[model samples]
Target chain A: MADGTTTAELDAPGDLVSVADRLDGWLEELDEPETLVEGRREAWERYRELPMPQTASEEWRYTDVEDLRPEDFGFVEPEAARSVEIEDLPATVQEVLAGEQDRSGVAVQVDAGEVYRRLDPELEEQGVVFAPIVEVARERPELLEDRLFSSEVTDAEEKFWTLHRAIFSGGYLLYVPENVRVPEPVHAFRYLEREDAIVGSHTLVVAERGAEVTCVEEFLSPDLEETSLSVGGVEVFAGENATVRYISLQRYGRGVEHYSVQHATTGKDSHLSGFNVALGSDRHRADVTSHVEGPGSESEMLALWFGDGDQHIDHHTLQYHKAPHAYSDLLYKGALTDRGRSVFRGVIRVAQEAQLTDAYQTNRNLLLSEDSHANALPNLEIEADDVRCSHGATVGQVDESQLFYLKSRGLTPLQAERLLVFGFFEEVLGRVPVEGVRSRVRSAIERKLGF
Target chain B: MADKLLEVRDLHVTVEDEDIEILKGVDLEVDHGEIHALMGPNGSGKSTLAKLISGHPSFIASRGEVLYEGDDVLEMEPDERARAGVFMAFQYPSEIPGVSISNFLRTAINAGRDEEDEISVFDFRKRLKDALELLDMDESFADRYVNDGFSGGEKKRNEILQMAVLQPTLALLDETDSGLDIDALKVVADGVNRIGDQNQDLGVLLITHYQRILNYIEPDRVHVMIDGKIVESGGPELAEQLEEQGYDWLREEKEPVSA
Candidate 1:
């Protein structure tokens, strides 16, 4: 904090492993409760003991993270609470604020830049909590203690998750009390536009019995330079007969290396939707899962991405059915252009007790450039004889007849191509349940396409 | 620059990848304000000539001259040729999902106009609405995707609607009468006749296997094509002859020349 630019602990640069080794003490100092300090200490020790996942690991086969040196990134403050007024925001944000969208609340986190939160008064009166997780931890410790780091992804997870749990700088928590259904969606805008920085952002949502809420979280950046590392995790807890819709849109700058883990655990007869749209990031890997721990639960997982330039996007998903009469459907679609590449690996696992389970998974890719490539692996593991599971994957170029038809109508080649690509992506984007989030996502994709 | 509205001379065309010639030395001409029908048997290369004139990538015209309004139509891209007022109604129009009819039409309408002279929303909407009514299309059809789930007759009628909107100087209708019932054929024929009345100087080259469409929209001249060449040229009475007595007699008559 000498010059107020770089923090004291991260001021000195070290090699990758050494920097990975030294982040624990900073996290320990940053925690509020002594319990979190202990949690950070133990998680850090475990993170050090575990080796980083490599290309040799089957889960990381197509991904290469060797060039990501830990010493090149460090945590910085999100500047300050500068100009939180709606008009002073980005044009997209301003446009969103202009209309009276169905919104319960909105929060904007700009890098270590600034944080602005606006909670609907009526919703807040109804005991809907949308605030920093730290505040929630202080006010309602019991609610978070049992749920924090309780992801079914397991304690022995990959290195990024281990690091995230160890030193996650900031995150949000949304809590909907029993039977208090929220009518509008909660918007969270997370902007990471820092130079050579590491950001660990997390979000946790808990919907009690019969409660319903939708959360839309988007990652953004106006100006990006050098390299930035983003480690994000989102976990949802749905109680009996509750419903939760979670949308995560990552359209960060191309100078980013983003890794995310999103998972949800649903109780009896609950429904959960985890939608993801990854359009930016030079290299990105996202692993999303739904663990149906209760009977008669259903989960819908959908994802859409358009990779331009030489960006490499990789996605892995899981539909883990541990209870009977569970249902899950997953679809992932992408369009690649100009040497861009994408890989999709998904699995639907039904346990023996999960009889009468139904699951389906499909992945489709359209190649807009000859050199672009798509790799898909959709797998199913069923231990129950009474379960039905199916998976399909396809990779092909745009239909030639479709192109010729548009061109014959006087559209230029590039315009005709972009229209087809957008049509291909609509299958996934159109499924988003939040209207504000959907339009903002559309605009983001439009901007990325340079239209 | 030239009195001839559309001219084709010594056209020798083949599929791009193969040596098999589809059109061998085709010669035809259509004066302004005239309608010419190219009646041919199946696989006789009538559609191939239309595709070649519009610069379709699949076909290569090895030797030919196609002059449209004094411009070399063969030297242009399909889109450029279309912008230059040479229209080709596809035999099988492609389907595009998620692109609404309104947006597609608006884009096409704007593509050929200068930046400052781009069609205004009010004018474009008026034109589209008028065309939609003329085609008997439901107003809500404006929001539907282009040809994605259209019936055969609907797709052909839509093609005619596009031709009316574009107001091309020359139109090449390839099998527009195929796969259509009498009612649909009359509707499509009426749409073409409407275009003819609106653009009196327009020239049309209508290619069809059957002369059924001719009963509604009369052709000024008729040319019988076989084995990629125009074997015979005659008046409207020839279509009636072909309709009553199929193409076998003509095939036998042109055996020596075709071989």
Candidate 2:
């Protein structure tokens, strides 16, 4: 409770510190887990002590985070009537949701900081806790005490994480007991819909030893004309020999700003794989960090993005090997057209204790138009004597010979170029193990290409 | 000679971006049902001649008139030339990923077919099967990406498969046997031979630097090209002669000494 209180106080807005006080008062009304309260408070204090990240920070170099001022956006609760109306779902998202038939697991919908839907009775009976962050704090304090904000592996890298910790209002939390495997994917969707609306959603997933689960978090909007901001953080903990797959698809409409931090910690012999497909947003930035802390662990990160018409997609990735005999492989591919731009900065760091680590990082870009731009910076920092680490970045255009060959075979130039671009994206899109997600991503890419 | 399938007169061409002319002045004529083998050294403009006749945009035809069945081909686009019965098997084929061989071959065939005609999937499959069988290629090859991960012999064989499907009037085999081993070369040669026999009206222009392919599909006329001009014209015996004497002896002789 002390740590949670401190965190709330530290996160209190300067002019509107009373907002934090009011939030704390609201949190006290719920039945929260004691341990979670302490953990949240400690995270709050730590966040208050940390300074805002500037361009000097290696992770913040390419991304413009200075424009993200807390004073510019204030917390505003979503309208209850519109929040509960399912018919307001965007046409694209409605189409996807209507097509989905397998709804066996938990289904959650969060508008702003309010939870509109939750269906997880069987999970509750199996000792699996699936609830909103505030409820998780009130009900399972012990779980939050040690695991809530205690996973500090990615705290030092970005200023947004601290802000997320300080101001996060509500998010989804899931915990599966040891050896428990959820057959269906847990689905959560977040909606940011309003002018200057700011949302801080926190997602914490912990899979006990030998547990298996799949989680999908989707970010979207109801209207393209609204100016909105979203800062999200996701932390995944995989216990010994556990298997976890986390996928995040961000498709915010035009004029929306998004920033996200995703971190995964793997235990001995554990496996964690993540896929991110970013499509929409006027300005979007993401930091994905994977920490391999135990031997025999492996992590795979895959991402695909298509930027068109003044959109900017910036991604920073960190593959940290903290223990020996661990491995990580990351592959990111993107295509830019119609004056769009993208920047990818990836780092593979092998710590002193992480000997015999095998890590590889690669980023590839295809520039379809002359005005489209792509900048890639791949780096490596190795302190271990016995390790294999390599990084590469490539930027190229459609091969003229390939175009001629396809055209010679009766395909128009545009058709041929489309096929080649699809082939270039197949390397990353093929790795998405989920069929529905893959199809959705493909459809989004096609829409972006105006197909 | 009156049923000439291809007629080129005083053709002059140069490589793009350079004043160095490759095809200085060349004249040749090939009637229907004739396989003309053009043998030349590396820089004698054998490939440039093929491009000029096939309407390749990179080669500048300074002075030449290519008439295919009395239609001037210089005004046609590359694809138009292809549809108008000019087929050229590239010396080095480009690899196209994500486009399957069946799709590519079907598109090419449909493009060349009658405008009112449409190929159903069933008919396309049957045609593909028959073509693959004629080429002795595996059925799985049709489903693979076009020329992607294909071996040199497989690429050349795939080219011939295309030729068999499209059934072009004039087929230009440009160095198709360059990288193939003995077995692969035999397979490619046999495929070409089958296509030639099936389409008697097909005028074949076999461009190669080696005489091995001539052993399989005997050419009716062998034209020795030197400095972009046909210097010697004779039967297949000229190919055997050139194979033995090399181009050095022919390089020294300035005039067209009858073979």
Candidate 3:
């Protein structure tokens, strides 16, 4: 980014939106190769052409983004963070860093830049590349140049996609070569400490043939007072016969507005499964997709969300089957409390050549209060008659019979409801392959339920 | 007579939000060390009375009173009633997936304990072992999710196991033998019989639709119910008479003498 410090791009007074106009400085500052620098310029051009979504836009009809006027938010410096030592971190981060649980490695990121990362010496000897993208650019420039701006997501086609490309700063690059299996999970934490600053980062995970790996990334905010913004994206590449699991947990404070796009591409005979747990954020929009491009590929997409207060959480997913004998399943479950609201929209598409494909999508929501709301839309498009695809969704309140059953056993109404809610989430959380992340997600859910 | 374990005086209960009176002025009593069988035909409001005593919100107790050892229980919450030692083995136990039986039962036991008298882990384990042996249940049963994917008879057995662990003063069995084979029936009846023998002051109210379960666990008193009211109260022979002639004779007797 530009040396050390730069003034924030304050929007003009009385104007509702023009935040997208500040992308010129960010795009010019991106440290990139000559070939991709041209791509970045085009991305900026397309971003200018792409219109910010209005309230009635079909892409976000279920969610109203009218309040997100560009004039209300401004972009901060790429490395705008007040560095803190590990011991001076929040108790939550300290507890995680104490190494009570087994992890392959851990990295701490603030303001889209990694401050500290530690990996086992054995992994370095084994030639596993786990480091921040900037370090990767300096040490392994070709690897970053090849995969940096090249993802299944188009740069300027969608507003969020274009915005992510034009203003993105720093993120993680996890590479596991052929036949290498990381025995334990790798962890990364992303946070923001400055008020009225915006962070856009991208995470890329490329697993070579026959590789197996699991990585977890969490997002946090130091305070919940002033408005902050975070725009992030993830791309996972699972090579032939490779198995990859990537989990992203977003718990930004209430004053933060978050947007992310998580997508993965699986090749022949590969398996890709992960989780998206969106627990906090005043307004969150996460777009997650899985594309099965090779024969015998499998993809499992799972998500869990809890929206309390007036929080608005949105999750959109796409399962694209491109080759024969591919299987894809997506399940998104959420619980809404108080005046909270959530939206889940998932689509499964099987191309004509994708015969013998099997796909299923389901969304289940539990409304803890009458004031809360949940909208689920599951769509499917099959160009092949031989494919088997189905979608189902259900929205209801806490089961009265189940609640009474618990209360009758001597638990109060609150305890019974919480237990039942936990049970409701267990069905999908059980699918989380990594034990450590699963337990962390469990504790987070418990905290949400307690509140 | 020994101290009264439970007393019901002219109890009247109706379905909440509707004028449908399910338990119409029913009166009954069970003293210490007594086993009472409440027998009735299908749709005879037998389950309603069981739910009423357990303080189910769906049932409104319009009149009368329920006293447990001289304290009024009608005003208490369901959980309060449970903590006060009133246990009702539901006819259809719920399946709580993802929660193991051990955790659920421990919570129940912990809820019933006084803050200062919380059971130690050693004691809880010992009690669980003793109860398991008394019920002839396997060790794996404690780890399984509570009633989730359990067979009909297994659910009934789980109910008895809860009773064995809780050791309530007044135990209400609501059709606990309806869906059991003869072997499963013996296991459940044997467990209740052993509990009764051990706790001589414990009172048992076994509600059943048929006389099959009464055959396994002999009762000190039998009451015949029809149309939400008890039609006959006598010795164990009352259950035998209803099993043989069915509720037709009781219906004929319950009606006023025609003309």
The predictions' CA RMSDs to the true structure, in order, are: 4.2, 6.0, 4.0
- Interface RMSD for candidates 1 onward, in order: 1.3, 2.8, 1.5
lDDT of 2 by residue, A33-81 (tens): 5554444455556655666667676666666665555435655432221
True contacts kept of each: 0.55, 0.27, 0.53
* A104 Cα displacement, candidate 3 (Å): 0.9
Tell me the spans in candidate 1 whose CA falls farther than 4 Å from its real position: A1-24, A27-31, A67-72, A77-102, A112-114, A154-157, A293-296, A447-450, B257-259
Predictions ranked by DockQ, top down? 3, 1, 2
Model 3: CAPRI class: medium
DockQ of each: 0.57, 0.32, 0.63
Q: What is the TM-score of chain A in candidate 2?
A: 0.87
Residue pairs with colliding backbones in model 3 are none
lDDT of 1 by residue, B23-53 (tens): 9999999988899999989999999999888
TM-score of each: 0.91, 0.85, 0.92
* Best-performing candidate as measured by TM-score: 3
Q: State the lDDT at B169 in candidate 3.
A: 83
lDDT of 1 by residue, A1-451 (tens): 0011222221223323333545655654563676766776776777677766777776777887755654346655323233355544566555666764668888876664334677778988898888666666677788787788778674324677876776665577899999999888888877775667787778999999999999988787654677778888888999999999999888777788889988899899999998988887888889898998889998999998888888999999989999999899998998888899999999899999999999999999988788999999888888999988999999999898888888888877877877787777777877888776677667766766678
